[model samples]
Target chain A: MSTDSAAGLLHDLAEYRARARRDRHGYWLPLLVFGVLILAAPLVYLPPSEWPPPRVQVSADGLFPGQIKVFGLTIEPLYMFGPGNGREIGNPMGVSWYWFGVVVLGLAGTVGWYRWRARRVGVETPTRLVVLAGSVGLLFLLGVVPLILGQALVLLFPGSYFYSNTAFWISVEVFVLAAAGTTVALWVRGGGPRPAWRVALASVGVVVALMSITIVFEAAFGHGHAPLLLLSVALLAVAAIERSAFCAVIAALFTAAALLANLYNMENVFYRFGFHVDYLNPRGEVFANLLLPAAVLIVGGGIAAWSARKASRRE
Target chain B: MSDHPTAGLDDVVHQKHRLAILTIAAEAKRVEFGYLQQNLDLTKGNLSRHITVLAEAGLLDVEKGYDGKRPKTWVRVTSAGRRALAEEIATLRALVARHENLS
Candidate 1:
């Protein structure tokens, strides 16, 4: 080939990589869908009467024994358990249940979306990574980490702290189920067994069904909600699958959103940047928790969508 | 070592389609056979020949599997393949620079 032909091949190589990335990573839809869902999540925390008086009743029982002072603001945590009722940042069981539904559904919906995309695009990206991360994280947080610490406390401190020894066995059982679920997922991907890869996969599907009913029950009614741990892990998995930097951003945003939602009033983080949500409503803090992550997802989705369009036009 | 950029071109990776395949495979963990076929604009048999040559040369790993009922094939570049592509691209860039200077 001529030198001109060689140079043209060099340019085409880049085009090919770009084309594969664009076609496989149709991640915008899920981002938009989950963004809307994230936006709607905190709506449940709205006070019964629009304007409740600014919280002033101090209580002795907080999630921890002390206040975290940040930027000269006594950062309000979502939960406080003292003898006197310490003010909760926003205590509504409804918010917890909503996130419970959103997370379980979001992860499940993502798997389903990939399956449907496989039918159309004819390229299968294993979604088991996402499910595996979510399940493992779920079992680890509610079971292993707490169980280990709980056991350590009981062993070292004795009567001072009471850890549940009975739950350890249950946690081990759920891990086995998760392992089987993963094997089935791999078997499906590996083209094992003669009659459709997942006649073998369904045998494994039953394991997943079992896990869905395990320690996750606690996540359903966690004090406020199981921090968007499920969503965060799932997003990270997709980031790896697509090799999309934008998806990684969405994952990081969700993780930060989850942590802030759990420990500190999200409004306080915004307060540090001179953006106060108090003027928005008496329940500004609740909106603060959900709003930032929501904006990130929607805006991130739009950016991804725009890039996809631009890529297609150029192609 | 040679004075000319042509001396740097890797024989296996210098071909147009093979270079494209390595570049695409390097962009993701692995790529579907159909994706390579479509993007390369080659017939299944033609693509198979190139893939076979690359695989035999230890430049790519071919995985035959299924996505549901449909048969699927995945192709990924080996570490040696990545090194080869990088070396080939660097040489091609040098050749292009030479052309630009001569023009």
Candidate 2:
């Protein structure tokens, strides 16, 4: 090629790079939707019974213990045992809904973080179709199926062993195992340069990890079961906004950390509730809980690092 | 001579605008028409004509679709297109190198 053509090519190349660099648009819409979601979820989730109880009347003398007023609304504190123990227990439903809202907000936060990272890396922002399909599929697989199967198993056994506890364990095992399996699969297959079944599996793995963590954490906190709807929205939002497998990996890491904490705490909580499983022993539980999630994170991170190195080498 | 650096340059692929389109498409994997036009500072008619030329030459693939309500177009470099771009870039680099040597 002539020197002029060579110079022109270099100039065009520079222009292309400059344009891509200037294509930086913030993810404001996703952020707005996330805010609306966080606010709206509690409204939809709170049952009428959970609405703040009819305003309690404080004695005009103000000598009553635990009597407080805020915004002219009299408040009575609930005490397990005290002179002013007239406080009614707040509806558990309300508490559950509140945490559920937090969980959804947490998911939104994760997506926002990933979306910003995606702009830097040039990961394609996921399309609406991808988001819808991924969220719906995860809900069907991890939520609906588990509940139905758990109920059916309870009915079939009619034993205390097979009741709520059995169903809960079964669901956890399925979700965690699926997440680990998918992560390992993706790690082995390597999601690079093209979309493959491994890509789909990686998505499944991330969704299942999120679900498993939500369930385990809710159970640990004695919070109300977070509705699957919140999880579906979280998955949809994250899937829609994030295009990198790294986001999925980050999500998996978050879930794994939660799982480790929950597992350690589960022994004490479940033991107190008169539930004893073999792995409750300090050493055994350590082996049981730490093995899968920890291994998944370690192995997945290693594989991803290696794959990136390999790709860079190829380039 | 057949060994001349310009011998490797493909006429249909080496045009500056098409080279820009190919480079963007190669980097993005799939690039929208509006993106190319905006980036290259070309009018719609001009971009459309250049894209048609590249597509007819089998240097890239043009896909027509809708982005929500608005009509949209995307261009992607095919395997042939990628090879052509790579070869063109290599030749340009060689030409630059030869000129640098002479200077």
Q: Write the per-residue lDDT of candidate 1 for residues B1-103, one digit (tens) a residue.
A: 5579888777778788888888888776577788778888999999999999899999999999876688888888899999999999888888888889889
DockQ of each: 0.27, 0.22
lDDT (tens digit, per residue) of candidate 1 on A28-128: 87788888987876555555466353544445533222333444434323221111122243434344445556766777888888777755664556667
What is the DockQ (computed on Cα atoms) for candidate 1?
0.27
After superposition, the stretches of candidate 2 with alpha carbons farther than 4 Å from their true spots are A2-11, A14-26, A47-129, A132-144, A151-315, B1-9, B25-35, B43-45, B63-103
Sort candidate 1 into its docking category: acceptable
Candidate 2's docking class is incorrect
* Candidate number achieving the greatest DockQ relative to the actual structure: 1
- For model 2 the local lDDT of residue A160 reads 56
User: Which ten-residue region of model 2 chain B has the weakest summed lDDT?
Assistant: B26-35
Clashing pairs in 2: none
Provide TM-scores for the models. Answer: 0.59, 0.44
Q: For this target, which candidate reaches the highest TM-score against the unseen true structure?
A: 1
